[model samples]
Target: MNGAGCGSCHSAPGVWPEGEVGPSLDSFAQQTLIAGRLPNRADILADYVRNAPKYVPQSGMPAMPLTEEEARDVAAYLYTLGRR
Candidate 1:
């Protein structure tokens, strides 16, 4: 789910150019917050990923509408991306 969707824009080896569209998740685990406001907790980020549209109507990000389980899985995957 998230792998297919987000991976389209964020694969490895320069697939996703670093810029304003969205920050790379490679270092997301180290970040203190998402979008510079929301805390960078796994659950919070998962919720945001599941329902980005509700929080920011004008955001270009599309809503994924993931189930709680899916969100948790994806968030777990993301958290593993840049772990030290």
Candidate 2:
């Protein structure tokens, strides 16, 4: 997701320079809510990863140019953040 600039705004365990533009995704697996509103499930997380604006129109995050599978993959990866 480097090409999508996810690391620029989010920081996992090993990633660095987690930008302040968005919240750090360090403990994503343990998060009870996604974006502070939606349920923290894989499907919801995938949708949020692809089009956060759809869930929250006022969200600062824009729609990501990723396919459904790509978004799902990203969501799955995010879910593994705090697992280790």
Candidate that scores best on TM-score: 2
For model 1 the local lDDT of residue 30 reads: 73
Residue-wise C-alpha lDDT for candidate 2, range 1-84, written one tens digit per residue: 655778778766666656668888887898899989999999889888889999999987889999999998899889888875
Estimate every model's Cα lDDT from 0 to 1: 0.69, 0.84
C-alpha displacement of 33 in model 2, angstroms? 0.3
Task: Indicate the residue-level lDDT of 52 in model 1.
Answer: 77
Measured with C-alpha atoms, the lDDT of residue 68 in candidate 1 is 87
User: What 10-residue stretch in candidate 1 is worst by lDDT?
Assistant: 11-20
Off by over 4 Å in 2: none
lDDT of 1 by residue, 18-79 (tens): 33455566766677877677888887888888887766777666778678898888778777
Which residue pairs in candidate 2 collide? none
What are the TM-scores, per candidate, against the unseen true structure? 0.73, 0.88
